[model samples]
Target: MTVIIFTVSVLCLLPQEVLARWACVRACPPSCTCTQEKSCSVLCDRSGLAELPKEFPCEASAINLDKNRLKFLSERAFGTLPSLKSLSLDHNNISFITPGAFKGLSNLVELKMAHNEYISYLHTRTFTGVKKLVHLDLSDCNLFSIPDRIFIEQTALKELLCFQNNFRRIPGAIRGMENLTHIYLERNKIEAVAYNSLLGLGSLKYLNLQENRINVIHEQAFQDLTRLENLYLNDNLLSDLPKLAFKGLSRLKMLNLGGNQLTNLSKTWFSDQVELEVLYLDRNQLLYIEEGTFENLTSLITLHLNSNNLTTLPFPVFQPIYFLGRLYLFRNPWECDCSLEWLKEWMENYKLVRDIPCASPSSVAGLDLGEVVFAKVNGTCVDPADLNLTTASSEITSTTENRFKSLIFTLIHPEFGDQMGNGTESLRNGTLIESEDGQLSAGVTGQRAWPSESLFCFIVMWLSLGLIGQSDLFFSLYCT
Candidate 1:
């Protein structure tokens, strides 16, 4: 009797198992292609799907509905897909998502809804139940703001991509995201970085804010991002930065501040950036840099100060950066006078020092600054402290005829003449000229000016000085 009862129990369970297999096979929608290997995957991409398919494999782990016409996602749209780990709805017209649309996707790890231009707003509880989401992409969307509690349940989220959006400010919804490590918010319209903008995001390692319109950053704006490694704020409208703008980012490795309107730098801006490796300050309006401005950046390996209005830098400004391997000082008006004699000596030890052209003092104008400095030094290592601290005019006043010739050269040189003509035009029009690097220069009218009568005499004197042989040197200097 016991054997007969056991046999009957086995017969009843076998039919139920077969029915479960049949149900899995019959659940796949006709418009979608389903595969059931280790786990089910559905691909309904580009099938003109206006709405979510009514039936999906019960054990479906991934779904791709990209390039569809889905406009709205109703509540419980993906009902109870406990095994769903990934979903892609990119390039769709999804305008609205109900509060509980992802309610039953408890195991979802990645969700992509990028390029949905109509999603300008979201409900507070839009992501109510997808607690295990680790990566989310909302790039190229029309989101101007995000509800503060929209990501409240996404505790495991690690990376968030929201680039090419219409946000005017950093979203406050990312306040408590402790596990978030990377954030891509480039190409947005963010105006300012407010205080405590990243309050609880201590784990954030990379933050990108390039190509924005950020003009102000609060002192404590990045106090909570102590572990951040890379921070990009390039291509902004920042004219000045607070002394403590980057207060708590001690572990930061790279900081990009290129393409801005800064006229000067404060010594205290990088006081805490001990681990910084690369720094970009090119394409600004900096006229001079103080001695102690880079005192704390001992580990800096690369520095960019090109495309600025700098005429001279203070002595020993870069003596603190011991590990510097690459230094870019091109595209600036560097007056290679006695004050800059130290740069030539410094360049000898580092072959990575880029060629810099002198912009003034007609004798060396348009010549490689390194060559001029080498010629002036003449194989003698002059002590910087012992050198005379007189003006370039006083040093070259051995004869009255030479002084008159220098004055004529300054007035007739094409470089200075063109500069004066443009400056006059800018003064008349009251507009700044856009430079080749896309930064605004004060007096660059992009027009050439005719040389004065003194140019003929200056050219005759130059030809008589037997300096024609240096033409190859000048060409090679720039070409190299």
Candidate 2:
């Protein structure tokens, strides 16, 4: 009788270990994952499991159930985990979760229920008990709206990712979360941005609103986001930027505004973002560029201006960009004319940006406007009639050309002096060998039948006259 009683007690302990081993089996909860420690967790994605029996494995600390077909978390579904700390139910078919689903998990610190095919939504404070929660990723979960209480209760939360949702209007300001540092709300159907949307998120650092239908952004929408580092609003319809659009984003490091329909590049509109490091403005319909357009971006490293309709870049346009390292100008319609004269030296000396197509009339496309091509074609002079610059202006360019002619003519032959004296007084004084341009101009201008042809003739004439007179005198003395 004693041996039979001991065997019965030992048999009872076998079921407990078998149950723990069964947690990792394919029949686990839809939102639960079995960990390597032989513990069952609700954080695993078990969407196909329909019903969850009572008394699940209670040793779970982290549960992953992101992509499952669970509709709700009933009271008994989560009653087993007395020490659960992390629960991930994202990418599941959960449309509704009763408040009693979390009745026993007072120790839960992290909860994720995003990307589920949800018809309902998670309003504010839907996760009230999990106050110690630090990270919440609800991106692409079809969250239409959320109440203010969602962030107010989770004070210890540090990162909140709610991008690619179905939020329509300006929901609520993400205020009062003193520890929140990152927020992502990209690819949503947001139309307008109201003020104070981020009133008290002091520690918030990175904000992404990329690929959204955000038509308008209020001026002070980012009023107090001073700690913000990077902001992405590319592929949005940001028609015009008001002067105060970047009011309090002083610490912003990068801003991307590519793939838009921007016409004017107002320097004052983005003057306040002093600490910005990179700016991307590619693929826009930008036509005009005012002076000092990029004056305030002192720390900017790389600027991408590819694929725009910029026909011409005004003179002194790149004057303020002293520290600029690499500039991209590919896919722009560059009017390669006299205005590009200032860029010849830089192009020859270094790898300056010039990967653009010349605009209009199919006259000059794909032409690499370099020194040999433009100078030979005289690409600088827009019209021969505008050679109407001041006579003094003539003092500058022609001195070298004429001096070169004079020097080469002297080197080749003897008497052609009269034509050289016909130059203007100012030209004569400046074109002599004393001037800076005159010496270099001799080697540069090869066209004027050798420079100063008349000057060379005059020298030959005087020398011949002296020698002839001396020879006659010497002959007469020898005869005496």
Candidate 3:
């Protein structure tokens, strides 16, 4: 570990805190229990140290000054440590840091500055002497930012953990770390990412970007990382997957985009990823699945898609999954209708397994679409005594249609009295009088009268005619 200091103006007015720090740095005992190999790897850990140890003889390689009531890091407190590699300053109350405080360290490897108080505006050359630095972690630090020249001299950095920060934009200096391969920027306030920020080194392989407020990414932001593999961009406000966002990557395998505002996934979303294998799209507001969405992902094996709103799986939804073996469709509010008839044959005919487990919203929970939802759903009932064609019979469809027509008239025209029957010469022989209507109405068609009105009027007319004849005879008898 080497001393890292911002080589700016030196402190001229030494406060009492600085006076105490200098006293400890030069006059500490030759040996202590908390220090090892010229470094206090576990010192000042809430152990009888009300204030920070001002002086640590430059023999310690690593120090643990966390969970202390230290209120400041006086200039040169850690400025001259020639052998320090790692430092723990977590859980501290030190808010003030003089410029050039850590000016001479050139071998620092890991630095933890989590859980601290306001330290904004990292002056340029803040890490002046630390040239072999690697694994710099500032997670949970009350830091607004480091200067654009923070990683100016150190290039051996491989992993950076900076999640839970206040970064609102992609750090333009990130492209300077050519050897960096893994980056953790999750759970942050980032809103946008620029492609040009990652223009060099091309060595990033794993990117953890979960739980961010990101809504946009330049199409070419990831064009340089040829070896990139796993990408996690879940829990975002993305509505669509840009076509050129992953333009140059050829080795990407797993992509997690589960929590987003994507409404539909079409082939245009995956037109470039020919090597994608595992795709997780859970907890999204997707409404449609376009067949072409997976056309280029011929190597896909596992697809997780639960907790969505879907009415039916269209025929084209399953067209591209020829080699698919596992599918998860539970937790989705599926509206089963006449369209469900296709799912049964869709599984058996396509040799797909019919094992689906229901998730929340108990309305459709624990029920299998093919075996339970469809098999026992309200089915058609057959009228055994029906003179019309039955559903059980394979008779001509036209016959069934005609029978349905007759049933409709019989059931709807109840005033027709005996009008419900087939009315064939054989069926009606004992009923309605033939040629009851004036126009020789063979049947209830255009020339025939309506069943209800015609029957009622004809009956009245017949009764009146009979009364007229009787009245004439009665009058004659009276006259005699």
| Candidate closest to the true structure, highest TM-score | 1
Per-model TM against the reference: 0.73, 0.68, 0.65
Instruction: Report the lDDT tens digits of candidate 1 across residue range 1-480.
Output: 557445433433465456355444456777888887777789899999898886556567899999999999999787666778999999999999988988878899999999999999889998888999999999999999898888988999999999999999999889979999999999999999999688999999999999999999988789999999999999999999998988888999999999999998888889889999999999988887777889999889999999999988766787798448898999998877766777776777667886788886666778876777433356664332223333343443333234235435444343454344433321222123444665433322353222332344344445443343342233223211
**Pairs that collide, model 1:** none
Candidate 2 lDDT over 368-461, as tens digits, reads: 5552233332444441123333333565445434434444464453243334444333233322222344332221122232245434433443
Off by over 4 Å in 1: 1-27, 36-39, 373-480
Off by over 4 Å in 2: 1-33, 36-47, 52-56, 75-77, 80-83, 343-348, 352-354, 360-363, 368-372, 376-480
- Compared with the true structure, what per-residue lDDT tens digits does model 3 show for residues 395-437? 4343333433432444355446355343632112212223544
Best by lDDT: 1
The TM-score between candidate 3 and the true structure equals: 0.65
Question: Which candidate would rank higher by TM-score, 1 or 2?
Answer: 1
Error of 2 at 393 (Å): 23
The lDDT of each candidate is 0.77, 0.63, 0.61
